[model samples]
Target: MTLPFPSLEDLVNVISSTVDYIVNIVYNTIRGALIDFYNWLMASIEWLLNYIRANLPFVISVVLTWTALYKSVTAENIPLTRRIMNILTAPLFSMFALSLVDALLPREIKLPRYSYPALAIASVYAETEARAEYIIRHRTGYVVEAEAETEARAIYSLGS
Candidate 1:
């Protein structure tokens, strides 16, 4: 039996296409993963906000205020130069903080009779258990969701 050999131009075209396929895969993988992660984060935040609004307004306010304070502190810990720059941009930071409090705190929680600080404290107890997930979880964070999404896409393409 005679074996058929691949022609020179045919071999080159095959190699080029193969490389293109690999590149496309890698790019699509990363892009898909990021999209997935972003979608996941947005969905989670929306769920949290809606949930807090409907079933846990008071608790949501407290948790949100805590989240604001925590984020501000973290932002404050930047290197001296960046810290100075951020301080210079103080209004920007304050705006961001206020926005968090505004967005996360349900209006019902703002009734005239309510005590903001007290509610936050009460929320602290309620949200304390999940604190570590955001405060203490490993560095992967939302990035991992993106990565996993990409990996799944690549695997599916290969398997199919």
Candidate 2:
């Protein structure tokens, strides 16, 4: 008499085939996802490069303007007339500075255009931080002085 159920070998074969199928499915899914991600990353980089290339001149202009304005506003040693003159002729000064730098740098070694905007942004951040610190210091000093004055008044009142 033979058993009606499948043989052990047949059951093992079926299980192995199912596992292989599932593994292949998973592998294909992951590979497709990775390819999509890679494509998106490359597209984003290309767009960024194109945008920077297109806007480089505008970026340089903004950097030069910001630098000139910041320097003119912050120059304590200069007379008011000189500061006004500097502000009025900021464009010429900026051009001269750029020309000087271009003349000084080695022709073989070119600097990236992005560095100009980055440096300008850094300078603005630094100035903002300094101004914030100054305000905070003065505010705390005023608070301390007020507290001391209040304490002195309380002491005088008690003595009287």
Alpha-carbon local distance difference test for all models: 0.49, 0.55
Best by TM-score: 2
lDDT of 2 by residue, 1-160 (tens): 8899999999999999999999998997786566556656655675676666555545665689788888988989999999888888887766765666555544432222110010111223545552111111111132111123334333332322
Error of 2 at 75 (Å): 5.6
Counting clashing residue pairs in each candidate, in order, gives 0, 0
lDDT of 2 at 87: 85
Residue 105's lDDT in candidate 1 = 59
Residue pairs of candidate 1 with colliding backbone atoms = none
Model 2 clash tally, residue pairs: 0
Q: lDDT tens digits, residues 68-159, model 1?
A: 55555578456767655554565555556556665675654221111111111112436554221111111233211112333533333232
Q: How does each model score on TM-score?
A: 0.31, 0.43
